[model samples]
Target: MTDVEALRQQVAGLMPKVRQDLERLVRIPSISAAGYDAEPVRTSAEATAEILNDAGLAARVIDGEGGHPAVIGSISAPDGAPMVLLYAHHDVQPTGPEELWSTPPFEPTERDGRLFARGAADDKAGVMVHAAAIRAWDGRPPVGVSVFIEGEEEAGSEHLPDLLARYADHLRADAVILADSTNWRVGQPALTTSLRGLVGCTIEVRTLDHAVHSGMYGGPIPDALTALCRTLAALHDERGTVAVPGLKSEPSDPLDLQEDEFRAWAGVRPGVEMIGEGGLTERLWTKPAAYVLAIDAPRTKEAPGQLVPSVRATVGLRVAPGDSAADAVGALVDHLKASVPWGAELTVLDSFSGEPYRV
Candidate 1:
């Protein structure tokens, strides 16, 4: 057999162990969001380091300024080969409403050749990819490899700047591979070269100086909640596209994805129709999207009969490439102010921006 075939066999032979290690990682609930236990996040970092250590690298878990622990592993080049940096995250997103899950969120269950778990694919698999590649080479690769398994990526990577500054030399590489995107197909992997930035903010609408009986003031006076709902509704047009002007948009590269496939993947309901005006790939990749994440208001059970004085909502914008997040957020604030009905007062509680970048 040829050398290429031999390498393929080595990789295939290594799958069982890789799957085992991946299962080990999937079991750790490394949720980095506030109010969750921090110990699990730390445990995931240590587990990632251990996997890399077994793959013949010098690995360790290190903490950044007010950040969750990150795992770093390094293997030196034999002589003159280029250094490659592999990036992944050890932390997983919170498993929301566990009752909705078909199986336990932390338990790795195999069904029809696919593993079901919270972090099984998004990014515990990435960590194992690095480990398996090194093991395939018998712990000695022709090129240098440096691995960075982030611990708080799902929580917006809040402290990434500190980690990058502190570990500049160790992470410097000729090329970087962040294994945090979708594969082109089941067996065909994709390389993400461009990414949209983010803008998030909380806005408050105050329509009443004081709470008044909704029944008594029903006809003439307006409530803050109603005004807030109107403002949020104006974020999209009749076509369901983002109505905010001045946000950058570019067509995505055409792909072989069908609407049925997208609906299936997204778990769209039987009667729900897809919105937005673009090819599926364009809508998914390049075009801008606005989402209302949450609204902070009194619960229905404990709600008083009085009209709400003020209501606050947290919204997010996915900024397209070539648009600065600062500019997009400014436009968003302007749009909210314009959309508020009955001249309700609009106040931007806080805002955050992340500049869009392309490789």
Candidate 2:
């Protein structure tokens, strides 16, 4: 058989074992966020390295500065072969609420052809794919290979750039396969590109020293919560497009994912239409989108019927790839400052921002 055909046959034979290994790794809840415990993250990384070693590579853990440990492994090929880099991560996002999942998020379960777990679809499957492909190559391919599986991608790869730089020589390759988070249909493959830059800010509006009865002070005094919501509401137009200046980018030609297929894949409610116009790719990849992620104002359970003293909310902006987070945030802040209703005093604080990458 031809090399490609041979590789495909080998990988086909290894699929069952690969699925088992992926399930084994996905069973562990390797959350790397600040609030979650760290041992699981470490355990997942170490276990991943062991998997790679068993596949005929020298693998071990490298301690990232503050994030979870990173996994690096290498397998040598014959001299004069090309080297490729394989990337993946071991950690996952928190399961969120238990009710949101059909099955327990940490418990790896299989229904139909797809595996269901918090990390199953994310990176655990990617890791298994890499292992299967390499093992199909039988310890060495026509090319050299190095793998870097991280433990903190979901929490932002805070320390990976440094790790990449530190191990630059080892990671140098003709191509890098980042198999952490993306897919296009089950059979069709996709190479994800152009990540939207993200910037977030919280605006706090303070009006009186303390809470007062709404019946008495509702007319003259400003309700901080109302003012905050109004300001946030103005950030988007009636069509859901961002209304802020300089935050928008040139829209690109839209991509075509079959409408019925997309709806079914996303599990959208029947008869619900998709939002925005143009190509699916253009709307998501090139345009700016603003959302109010959270409101930190007093809860109604504790909120007195009062002209509240203060209210706060968070705004998140997803800018096109070329747009800078700083500039987008500056425009957003400016718009909020100018748009505050009445003579209400406003305080805006910029929060974490990550430069959007074009992968």
Candidate 3:
């Protein structure tokens, strides 16, 4: 048989084992977000290292400056051969509202030719794909292989630069396969050419030193929450394009998503009009602008009938490729300051920002 046929046969034979391995990994609640225990994160890293070891690479867990653990492994190739780096993350997002899930988020369930669980597709599957490729070659591929499974991608990858610096020599390779993106379709493979970088900040608007009764202060004085809302609403224009000046954008390659498919993928509610003016892909992939991630205002259930004294909100800015994250962040802060109503006291807190990258 030809090498292609032999490889296909090997992959076919490995499917059952791969499924079991994925199930075992999906069982771990390795949430690296705040408020979750760190033990599960470490345990998941250890398990990933063991998988790498089974794939015939010398694997071990390494801790970064942030204290989260990561798995690294390597198998050297013959002289003059190229080296390849495989990248994935093992940590998962917090399973929000367990009641919404058909099965327990930690328990893997198979139905309709799909596996349902947190991290199943997002990255645990990525780890398994790397392992399967290594096993297909009997743990000895013609080219060098290095595995880097990170543990804190869901948490903004806060310390990734430090981790990369610390392990610079070991992680270096001619090419890197970041197995964290989506395929074009179920049967189609795709390579992501570019990614937008992110910058964000939390702004606190303080209209009053303390809450005042709304009945007495309602008409002439605007509450801090209302002021914050108005400022946020001003971020986009009538056509829903971002109004922030000084932000940068570039021309993107033409690729269109049909509106029906987009609505299905985005879960947009019926009767809701799509925002922003431009080609859909251009607006999504090439734009730099504002997005409110979270607000720290009081919940409706817990809120009193008094005027809000202060409101804090986290605003995320997606920097276009070729734009500087720091400059984008400065423009965001400037826009928020310029848009504040009634000269309300504003304090902008800087959060982590990532530089935009192109491949």
Candidate 4:
């Protein structure tokens, strides 16, 4: 029988080293967002390879075709044991406006018994967890362990299929455990059972041939910004439930989650009623949601008193499970086209989609 107490103590003893290794990874600024430097991502991949190797896995850094570097590491299991694939991504989302951060985005800081930094938990933490498990076993885990640390998950895992195809043999396993996700709350463990697929596109709304003085065109003629805003507003109904037709929603299993507890946990402000027409868990897990992720227009301070000729927005939609990415994206595009006001010109570009998955 496994000695649970001994294992717990052994893990507790090595936490400092784990923290140090995680801090090293967090300092690398491996932002995989487009237009950022690529070198840091490669550096981060190499660092991940080193961490796995030091933990007794035979690891190396490899690049995906036309994509960023990824780290693959593995240790063989004892005879008759099963192979397990462990997954985590080293690449992090671009840190928008570092000025908003409490400390340097790459500098690991500890306060109130928590560490702060970009990628601190969003997966450098997961990577370290896997490493810690290996070390706790004294580098010989009971099952075969294969580690896959992709470098561009934040940038949308564009080449994951290629990588998987290339390394099919190395990654074969009886089970796969993704070292990622959020806990229910502090001291409460929760396994994430599903993730809604992602779909989105950049939409441009053009109202006029060229920019004109807003004072002259204000009442008589419409501006692209107003048209864009109106179109986006059409995405939801009176109850704030998604207004788009053809998008899917399914009833989720009930849980003991009350509105007050949800508000307290989610930081819902006073009098700000939550949107969506369903149980909170269903709305979050099974129903589709729409969001305006970003917009292209003049900055507020730099705005001129002119009727903008064109405006663009990135509309993102969470696709519910059992729905195809193709169908979800097609539905979104069709709705956006049908919803545009006053016959303003519309064009969609940079469409992207990821299929919803369950295991």
Candidate 5:
């Protein structure tokens, strides 16, 4: 039989064991986000290392600066062959509420030819795909294989750079396959060519030293909350397109999503017009803009019928591909400071920024 056919047979034979392995992994609640216990993350990393070792690779668990563990494994290739890196994460996102799940989040259950579990579809499945592929070749594929299963991806990948730098020599490869992203749809494959970067900051507006009765100072003096809202409104024009200056936007790829499909997917109510001034793909994928993430203001129940003295809001900006996140953040800060209404005092505090990737 040809190499391809031989590998296919081997994979078919390993399906049962693969399912068992995946179920074992899905049982671990390896949530690496804030407020979750860290022990399961380490346990998941150890389990991943063991799986890699079973596939004949020399596997080890390494901890990055964030103290989250990562599993690394490798197998040598035949002479004159290329080296390939397979990347996935071992940690899973938090199960929002147990009551929402029909079955326990950690218990792997199968229904309608699908496995149900917190990490079954996300990343633990990805880990099994790699393991099964390696096992098909008996851990001796034609091309070199390097496996990197990270633990902090769901937590924003804050320490990914540090981990990469620390293991540069071992993780080096001519090509990489990131198995975290979704396929276009089931049974269809797609290659993601571009992704937008992110930058965020908190803007605090102060117009008075203390609150005053609205009846006394409402007409002449604009409240800090009002000034902040006006400043935010200026970031988007009537068309809902971002109006921030010095931000970058680029022409999008040819692929487009139909308006009806988008509406159904986004759950837009009927008769509500969509905002933005360009093709949906370009506006979403290759654009720089602002979004209000959270606002710090009193609720209606807590209102004191007084003029607000200060307001704070967290704003997030998505930097388009081919643009630098640092530059985008700088421009956004300048825009917010210059846009404050009625000479209100403004302070912009940066939270975090991530560089965009195009691959």
Candidate 6:
């Protein structure tokens, strides 16, 4: 048999073992968000290192600045082979609202050939795929391999670029594979060439110092909720597009959803047509998407619907490749403050900001 066929057989033989390791890695709830367990994050990082070590790769834990530790591993190939750099993150997004999940999020369970877990689809699966492939070559392949498994990717990978620069000489290679992303859909292998960045802020409007009885002071008092609604409504124009200047440029690329595919993917019940014009890929990939993430105002549990003393909301703006994060946040704040309906006082607070990468 040819060398390629032999390599394929070796990989197929290790599939079961690789699946077990992947499930084990997924069981660790490595959430890097605040208020989550930090120990599990550390455990996941170490587990990744262990998997690399077992495969005969030089693996170790590296401390990160104010973030979960990173697992850095390396393995050399036989003489006269190419060197490839691989990257994957160990941290997972917080398993939100357990009620939404069919099974426990951290407990990796396989059904219908797909692993159901928090990090399974994200980077864990990618990690296990690489490990299995390397083990196919018995740790030493035809090409050199350097691996970087990070724990803070879900938290914005702020410290990763610095680490990469610091170890540039060690991690240098002809190609770098960032396995943290995937194709738009299953069964179609896609290389994500672009990613959208984000900027967000919280805006609060105040009308009264304390809650007032709506039955008594409804008409005279400037309602904070109404003011907030007006400001939010002004964010978009009659074209159903964002009114914030310099925020959305003309989209260049297209999105995945074609007309028929969009109707199915968006669950647009039968006769509904997709929103906005032009290519779906361009609309989602290159175009700007904006939304109101949350409102901090009192809910119906505590405050009566009648009382409109103060209102607050968090707005998120997804920027294109050329837009600036700081500029987007600033423009959003300015718009809200300038559009108050009842002359109510307004305050905008900037929150987390992530700049979009053109690559």
Better of 1 and 6 by lDDT: 1
Model 2: how far is 244 from its true place, Å?
A: 1.7
Q: Per-residue lDDT tens digits of candidate 4, residues 255-280?
A: 76788988998798999989998788
Task: Give per-residue CA lDDT, model 5, range 282-306, as digits (tens).
Answer: 8878987679999898788999989
RMSD of each: 1.7, 2.3, 1.8, 1.8, 2.7, 3.1
- Candidate 6 C-alpha lDDT tens digits along 1-359: 34998888998899888888989999999998888889998999899999988877898988787778888878875687778888888899998899999989988887887889899878898788678767988887778998888888888788888887877877888777888776677678788777777888888889989888888888778788878888888777766566777675555654444677756766888875455444677667676667788887777688784768888888888877777788877777787777888779988765767777676
Model 6 segments beyond 4 Å from truth?
A: 1-10, 76-83, 141-143, 158-169, 172-174, 248-256, 260-273
Full-model lDDT, candidate 4: 0.92
Q: How are the candidates ranked when ordered by TM-score, highest leading?
A: 1, 3, 4, 2, 5, 6
Residue lDDT tens for model 2, 120-212: 978888888777767887767678899999889899889988998999988888878878656667877788876788888988887777888
Which lDDT tens digits does candidate 1 get at residues 153-259?
A: 98988999999989999999999988887887777778788888899889999988888998998778889999999999999998889999888899877898889
Between candidates 1 and 6, name the one with more favorable TM-score: 1
TM-score for each candidate, following the candidate numbering: 0.95, 0.91, 0.95, 0.94, 0.88, 0.86
User: 179, model 3: CA deviation in Å?
Assistant: 0.8
Q: What stretches of model 4 exceed 4 Å from their correct place?
A: 256-261, 264-266
Q: Which candidate is the best by TM-score?
A: 1
Error of 2 at 117 (Å): 1.1
lDDT of each: 0.91, 0.83, 0.89, 0.92, 0.89, 0.80
Model 2: residues >4 Å from true position, as ranges? 76-80, 267-274
Instruction: Please say which candidate is ahead in lDDT: 4 or 5.
Output: 4
Alpha-carbon deviation at 120 in model 4, angstroms: 0.6
lDDT of 1: 0.91
- List, residue by residue over 1-359, the lDDT tens digit for candidate 3: 34998999999999998898888888999999988999999999999998889878899999977667999999996799889999999999999999999999999998788899999999999999999999999899989998899999998887788889989999999999999988765656778878888998999999999999999988888899999998898788887888888888988877746778878878999999988767777787888766899999989899898999999999988899989988888888888899989989889865668888889
Clashing pairs in 6: 253-282, 254-281, 254-282, 255-280, 255-281, 255-282
Any residue pairs clashing in model 2, and if so which? 214-305, 254-279
